[model samples]
Target: MIEGFTSSLAEVNGTRLHYVAGGQGDPVVLLPGWPRTWYQFHKIIPLLAQRYRVIAVDLRGMGDSDSPLPGTTRRPWPAIYTS
Candidate 1:
């Protein structure tokens, strides 16, 4: 898991998403299991950050992310860069 930073929120598909970003070489995205947050990646983030810009995101309704309202649209493609 990655470390050294707190999970932050980002707007994605019109919803606030929880995430943590670090490192400097290249952009890398990491996702955790259900009920888990970006914090789950804490142990690995620092090591990865040394070589790439690591980003771990909390899935909707989990962790620091805004509680997802019922019936919210599905957004399972965080791996695809939107911005």
Candidate 2:
């Protein structure tokens, strides 16, 4: 409910990821660095949305995205980030 943006949850590799998307055009995915959530791009979303479909996501173990279970291997971390 952030103006023109829409929030959603996606399940990938058994993990649920949270994201906000808006605008229409070529797709643009935004991934925030550690300790930050999708809201970090709030101020710029509107500007980017004008020319492209902006999708800001909350990476795993941060924000509303599900955290990995204790003892889980970190090997998949790279795949998660790239995908």
Scored by CA lDDT, what does every candidate get? 0.73, 0.88
The candidate that wins on lDDT is 2
TM-score of each: 0.75, 0.89
Task: Give me candidate 2's TM-score against the actual structure.
Answer: 0.89
| Candidate 2 lDDT, 8-73, residue by residue in tens | 999877778999999999999999989899999999999999999999999888899999867665
Candidate 1 — which residues are off by over 4 angstroms? 1-6, 73-83
How many backbone clashes are present in model 1?
9
**What RMSD, rounded to one decimal, does every model reach?**
3.4, 1.6
Rate residue 51 of model 2 by lDDT. 99
